[model samples]
Target: MNLQPDARRALGAGLVVIALVAFSNSSAHISDVGQQAAVAAVSSTDTLTQLNQSLISANKDKGVLKEGELLEKAVHRKALMEILAKENPAHFLRYVLNASQISSLPKSVTATVEKRISTEGVIDTYIIDDFEHPEKSHYEYYFKRGANVKSLYLVGDLLVRSNTQALITGYEGDTYVVADNTKGNVTIKANKDIDGGSNEALGVQNTAVILVDFDDSGPRPFTKEQAKNIFFNAQFNKFMKEQSYNKVSFKGDVYGWYRLSGPSMSNGQHVIPVFGNDNSQLNRIILENNIPIGNYGRVIIAINSDFTSSSQVGMTMQYIGGREYFFSSSWISLAGFDILAPFPFTWTDLDFLLAHELGHALGLMHANSWECG
Candidate 1:
């Protein structure tokens, strides 16, 4: 989706940069602050007007929605946001439920998540949704379940986003370990550490993923230079060995890295990395381009740095896991941490972030305290 340069700048500045704590080989926790958007809140009426204009532009560009129909939907969405805000507003980790889907869901879940969803966890009731899409509005995020036959509600995202300190929660096969105890807090621990191919990890196991980025001529977010240092650094590989009590060491070669340029990384709806196991647009592109897929895991990392052409959500990573490491992968921003961090940052912090996420992908759950239980 193309965004005008001016508009991207305007929104990116306000999009919250959620800074989270990355764990060590063990899920060591810490007191951390989310790098939230610094913009001042505008009146709801004015905010709705801007949203309405954007909705109109998006619909007109997509050439979808009947005359005034998109506006009606936007009005409904704005109203829903208001109602949801009253229920609990304070937007961060922004989310909005599909009105239609909500009605259809079993009463048990709708009752639970509807009451729990919010933007910033202030119980301020602010939630967000991309309702302009004719069919695939962001509101209806879903993932495949048994036998990969169909997509089911990623109700977990809603549940976690809606509630606080949501730890040890698993949906489908993926688990949510909000180890840090903060809103938008996430850590991935997969059980496939010991058995690289097994869906779950017995002890400490080995896992692999294809981490790639677009070869944009502009500055890179995480340069191949920087990625190599993080991925192949003596300490990084050493850290992996240490994670398994020196049993499962990645002497290198556990993951492959590539950079692609051109339209392959351009098509498809943008995917915001999340804690669930949904295949992203870049993953599809990788498949079409014949990138080898892993048996135990499959994911293509696309480092999107084009603020002028991208929707700016702070740094995020997504995975799909059930059992042990059925399939898990992630896409991360090049400069998300650098841009979001309030303190001076370096690769060490970034390395820990990777380590922490790996811990989650391998089936570990978060602890209420500083430990990874």
Candidate 2:
């Protein structure tokens, strides 16, 4: 056994998020009518016993090394030596071969020499008893120094004759580490997947709702009357529906457009905007001026005069858990303004933008895949 340390680590890491996939013990077979009975008549108890013993021994010796023990330079030789000598003799050859290389064995094991130190092999046996009763045993071994051990299972094969690949430049003794020699740009980063909700149903209480406010200094770009009129409009209402904004009920009265000078504040849709360079500045205005919505409640959009076009535009596209947003200007485009342009310019887009952004801010991402909505 003496499974590779890397394989043990990888398996442990994978189990943190997802359990291992169970391998099926019995595989389906398609054979001629007469073959079924003939194949069934074979006795594989002896072979199974041997294979089980080998697997047990291999499993026991696998990863008997402690952390910080260099896999190279025979650091784990003590643990491995004991297993090879006292545990299971059937798997003794597997450890010995993994340590170095096997010159010859039962013809069942076929070794395919890959580059210099790497070798790939497999052993497939079909045991037939009297009356031509047959049972098949398949083993694939990948022998690669310092390479991952889980890859062997993935490669599929037996303990002795499994297909394996060793990196010629693999580490020595117990450790296997290869040097990277690439000149190209290498990007190492985590992959992030978008979060979208189930589309099969919609609920009013569950719908995304966002309230936006640009801090008040005086009159905002739009008049307060103008903002309310837009929020009540029908076109914007349809847009929210498309973006998965279930139902929105104004939580507070519209405070007319106001000037943002020092800080931005948020009371649902009402905001006091403070002059700032970017979204961070906008965030500051809210943190400084606005009161927080309870842990579970409606969406709030806070706008500030201090927010520049760059800051607003940047905020429109970003995603945050349990929230969503849209800049007033960006809202126009996102609401399909061109389609609604023939109609009056109202606060509908603004309202819908709040709903959409809150959808994301709360925990939603666009589902461009679904056709229904």
Candidate 3:
């Protein structure tokens, strides 16, 4: 039909207006409903949650959001994470958007970022892990690198996205170098050092001697060789190097083993064993004159079968300056090996017990779970 131009334009305009009205009405309703759902879901608790978000928003520190303004309890938790989206978008973008857990993950590793990278954008998923000690006898872990992950911390290992130029800075209490990353994977264990210099990262490069002097009055379970082997094993050597003494790293050397010859040495302790001692003593002693205390920083371990941990297991102590430092050990000879009892013991256990004593000598307290973890 031949119609006037103005009439045709007017008809189109009317239809456009009707469509605009419908869209605006629908959008307003949707937005209002979405906001209401969010408030209702979050208001159940006075505390806001740790965010689990999209790849771009994951790991960003959202300061503690307080729901106390409208929530049931009307109380706020401490503001823990304060990160600005504008200041560091890298962190902001990594903030968690969603989170969930699975029974299959290992406790040693904290979290994982699953990302598939392509030229267009990123598709990321995250899994929150269980940190409580494991219930299983053996567990497995897998380290997978993707575009979204920057750094991840495990029990004793740290995985960073970049693998190049991976040099270990000094590692001390509760920190270790699993793999120097020079060649490949490494085992994780306590008392293991993250040495900056050694190829194995085992510990100090040089060796310092700790001479053991046995008393003639007691039974000796270990021949000089056996005692030396116990203290010089990989575990003991690595543990010693990983430690700090006098506010400095025990960085210079591994402990050397020596057996004093000729006469048996006199035991120095204000207290006695079995009746009132725990297979241990103070690290420093007032030496009986006429006895030679070799070079400064030298430690002499005097072992006597007569000494016992009040007939139980363990004890430890520390000392002050040189004229030589000495420590005493009490033990019962067990089938070819000198042992600490009150429980089943092994060479590894012995290493741990003695290293703990060394820590006492170095002025460290017996660390509880809180401190070590």
* lDDT by candidate, in order shown: 0.33, 0.27, 0.26
lDDT of candidate 1 over 218-287, digit per residue (tens): 5444544555455555453465454343433332233334555443234554434323333554444444
Among all windows of ten consecutive residues in candidate 2, which has the lowest summed lDDT? Answer: 15-24
Over the stretch 2-72, how does candidate 2's per-residue lDDT look in tens digits? 21223222222221111001111221121232144334422332333343344334335544432223122
Ranking by TM-score, best first?
Answer: 1, 2, 3
**Superior candidate under TM-score, 1 versus 2:** 1
Top-scoring candidate (lDDT): 1
Shift in Å, residue 137, candidate 3: 33
List the candidates ranked by lDDT, beginning with the highest: 1, 2, 3
Report the C-alpha displacement of residue 1, candidate 3, in angstroms: 81
> For residues 188-233, could you state the per-residue lDDT of candidate 3 as single tens digits?
2212112221122112322232333333434444555555555556
What are the runs in model 3 whose C-alpha is more than 4 Å off?
1-218, 242-298, 306-349
Candidate 1 error regions (>4 Å): 1-199, 202-206, 209-211, 214-233, 251-280, 298-325, 332-350, 365-368, 371-373
